[model samples]
Target: MSVRDLLVLGSASAVPTKARNHNGYLLRWDGHGLLFDPGEGTQRQMTYAGVSATDVTWICVTHFHGDHCLGVPGIVQRIARDGVEHPVDAVFPASGAAYWARLRHASAFRDTGVIRERPVSGERMPLDTGDAPFRLVARRLSHPVEAYGYRLEEPDGVTMLSGELAARGVRGPLVRRLQQDGRVTAPDGRTVTLEECGVTRPGQKVAFVMDTRLCDGVRELADGVDMLVIESTYLDEDAALAAEYGHLTAAQAARVAADAGVRHLVLTHFSERYRAEDEPRFAAEAAKAFDGEITLVHDLDRIAMPRRRTSGGGA
Candidate 1:
């Protein structure tokens, strides 16, 4: 069966607590699985999550931070170990080419998986997964390191209405002909157009924002996305610390989600200072700014993709 879900493997920032692991996420979008920021011990996490190394079609590293990209070597090695025949695309910041090279070749065994390199920089950069119709977009974020956020966007298309088609007396091969030719002659000899039987369907969009403070890129990435998975590394009380570390507070992340009209806001990458008991506080702080569905992420949690927008592009 086809699947579209975001699986949280790890959700800690900088350091891993007894409960939280490092920072790893897997977004299974249709035919492709996109692994983002595979931090320390991600291979084990994937095993625990019932995910296979062969499932990964793309690996996206937000930055070269140890807490973000340490597991790349393990994951890459595992991919080679599995001997996946398909090519896997690896996306990273262009500035961290040396860091990426070092990590990719940190320790080589038998190189078998065909891992393709795709580096991103400044403003908006596009990455193609080759399997999906949608393209992934990378936007620079305000971080101490060269960090980038990613977005998956599907192109606009038309949604056929069966009722309209029936009413137009379009059936059998004629229906396919109408779709292919844009117009078809009905039994009544009247010309029926595809537009008359279909409505404009807006594509779905998902965004991932991590390890960044309040910045224009954050807003741009989160803008009108069905789901926004962002990092909330600190509580509102430690806003200064968040700023100094180039991270977002729960409230700040929520405000960005609210301003960007995000449908669902997933706050993760928590600090070790906040225990599991303090999770409510994080959700409450974000609730103050955003009225959308707020999810305080935890390890091994799976979030399904939001339902597609209705015809006429209603959210």
Candidate 2:
């Protein structure tokens, strides 16, 4: 069966605590594994999360911050070490090309030439992923440094209405033909169109926003997405610090989700100032703004994507 989920490798922000490591998250969507914001100690964290270097299909870095891209060298080296045949795409801000080059060759090792550089430029743009099942887009974010966010959107499709099909006597092979050809002949010599027996099903969407203050890009990326993985670096009490450092507080993150109609809100990238006992406070603050599912993640947590919305229903 196909598996779609987010694997939390690490959740700490700039500093690492005994209970948390630097930032790292892996999104597994069927055959594609997108590794996002891999910070220091990501290799070890991946091992603990049961993720191998070969499983990574893409590495998306929001910025050149050490806590976001420091693990590039290790992951790249490990990819070469494992002799992963598939090409791994490395995506980041185009302005950070110099930093990426340094991290790509941080140490002397055999270069397998399997990692491809696909930097993101412009304010907002769709990335080329060949024939991937979903469309991937990048949008510029508000931060001291050049940062970007990513969104994955699947194509909308139609689901067959069993009741309609049975009523029309469109059973067995006729059902498949109706879906493929858009029309098929029923048992009573009647022609039935696909639209008459199917309802439009909106595609599933997920977004990743890291180390960015609230901005238009954040709203655009989170709009109606089924899952939103965002940074909540400070509490509402320290909103000033959050704005100064170009980050979001738990309440701010939740409000964004509520505004964008996000179904599952994942709050991560917490500061080290908060302790294990304080974790509940983050969820509590977020609950006031977002009534949907909220997850204050810990290292090695695996979160499943919300199920697809029912026909004619909102996510």
Worst 10 residues of 1 by lDDT: 126-135
RMSD of each: 1.3, 1.4
lDDT of 2 by residue, 179-271 (tens): 899999899999999999999898899999999999999999999999999999999999999999999999999999999999999999999
Q: Give, for candidate 2, the lowest lDDT window spanning 10 residues.
A: 306-315
Alpha-carbon deviation at 255 in model 2, angstroms: 0.5
Local accuracy of candidate 1 as per-residue lDDT tens digits, 114-139: 99999998788987656576889999
Candidate number achieving the greatest TM-score relative to the actual structure: 1
How well does candidate 2 score on lDDT at residue 140?
99
By lDDT, who's the top model here?
Answer: 2
Cα misplacement distance, residue 61 of candidate 1 (Å)? 0.7
